[model samples]
Target: MASALPNSLFQQYFNNNDYADIIVELKHPVQDTNCPKSTEYFPMHQIIACSTSTYFKEACFNAETNPIGTKLLFFDISLEAFTIIAAWVYGFRGSSFERLFTEKSIRGVMDFFIDHDLETDIYPEMQELRTLLLKNLFKITTEAEVASATGSPRMDLRSLEDICEYCLPGDRNTIRRLVKQQIPQIKCSAGWLEALAGKSAAGFLASILLEIYQEAQIQ
Candidate 1:
């Protein structure tokens, strides 16, 4: 269980942005042809970020650690994702996926969370982000859209498995669409079929397969 801080304190921290004690700097690696590296800075309260995120807590203010400077540099993550994470740390709602987040970008953030051993108890917002990402991925329509959303040719098998495991029970229609998109791969992959058969909600999987069979018969 997590302890709750007073709402007034969160509001106070948010209202006074100038009182930020830490700076999170995001940088892109140098590209070709003499184009300068891109960098963006986010000023944040150490207490808020550290309290909500294991990564920030360890990087910025682990009590027994040697001094890491005030400004922390991250090369792999995008400025937009970091900005939304920083806001969530301060008790503000994270931004919508349509505006800033993508499957690839959120995966980077998820890796950061995992590498730092971020606890869901400490950061409920991480759970929120995960759910949102799953929903958005299931909603995607095309191969090009998948490439654009995730920077991958297709949704990877692990991600598809996760969607089946977590999201299938809630919204079958969306899950059906997602599965339909991958039918070509699923038809050829014994591992995928076996994995779906092993799910707790095997009935749902059976229903989807039946629907596919019926559609094929009609065609």
Candidate 2:
């Protein structure tokens, strides 16, 4: 999912009550203004809206994109986008990126995940994360070759927007929501992010999500 509003921009407005009001208004803008048919800024607005939806995914985007509704769901959840959003929301709890990028705290979060192993635990935000990851993947992968190459653990995320621009338009929304959902769960844990930076994280998350769904089914 493309975020029309960047975290940096949102950060500037965070302290201003009026700006917060503007953001709140932006979230629930007038019906006509909500997802306009076509406009120069519609794409940008759509992306920003999708990004912010992480915080209010239930109120707005739930009906549009369901993670369990799609195949290859977790593959599409963009960890980078989620990372950016998470940092914005929880960065205050840590030191600077350089200062906080320590082995101990990172390991702490990873250990939390290893010991906790979500298994059947389904989070309210999983769908949102799937949406975001797909958006990032689409944005980064250009050709079939690039797409295939992305399966490698060493793939770069910065190329996401490029892949996104090339993918079919219809697939974008689904990708956005998946990623948005996962940001909150993963963000607070520095170790989670660090561990997920490698190749196996996507498959790990996918397996975890499937387990969650399976447990839900039995329940």
Candidate 3:
């Protein structure tokens, strides 16, 4: 016998701006030329943000401690990125993905996910978003002119270590291409290499080293 699917009560309220209980204020920093330093407001359901994000969950539920009180302020994240994140929290996956899925926007979203502890084991949506972001990042990394023209931020050693951890055993091509592109700059910094050696998994570390060695040999 075929079983009926359970009703999603929240889906009814999804995208209903009138029912929003929280207001998220996003701001861009003055130093970020890609976006204007301005504030933007996004109406969101407290329950949806709290349920999906640990940081929000703590802030919204533990009002006595956090004292968010219907309004939350976020600094240095672009309005476009926050809009996409807020919409995703409310299950609004639409054409917005095309507009919002840029290198800078993905980085902002990933920062939010990391701060909120949205790991794959705990929040499947976060994992899905991570994969999507990785694809966008890969595309940017592959196009040298585009990357340079956009002034893509260089990934730090810690960020590289995190990427290795996230990407290893799956997206080897992306990692290889990234390593090839960044090896010259990274090789100059012995401190970065040492940091990567200390943090990365043995197998992943070897793969990166192999890529660097191959690039050097080719040169």
Alpha-carbon local distance difference test for all models = 0.56, 0.33, 0.58
Ranking by TM-score: 3, 1, 2
Model 1 scores worst on lDDT over the 10 consecutive residues at 183-192
Question: What would the per-residue lDDT of candidate 2 be over residues 1-219, giving only the tens digit for each residue?
Answer: 234544566444432433121122111122376574321110112233335544334323433433433211111112322233333342222233223332233332233223333112243233333333344343333333344764422223333322332223344445334434422121223344344335342434433334434544576
Model 3, span 101-166: residue lDDT tens: 766777777776666566445555566666667766655544543455445434444545554554
Candidate 1, residue 206: lDDT: 49
TM-score of 1: 0.51
Note the residue pairs that clash in candidate 1: none
Candidate 2's TM-score reads 0.22
Please provide TM-scores, in order, for all candidate models, with all chains considered together: 0.51, 0.22, 0.54
Query: Model 2 scores what on Cα lDDT?
Result: 0.33
Which ten-residue region of model 3 has the weakest summed lDDT?
A: 1-10
User: Please, what are the lDDT tens digits per residue for candidate 1 over residues 1-219?
Assistant: 122775347546652547676766676545574886678776767667666655566666543322653545354456665655665566654343255556565555655555544535455556665556556555553354465765444555555555455443545676677677654334324345555766674547546655665666577
Clashes of each: 0, 40, 0
Q: List the residue pairs that clash in candidate 3.
A: none
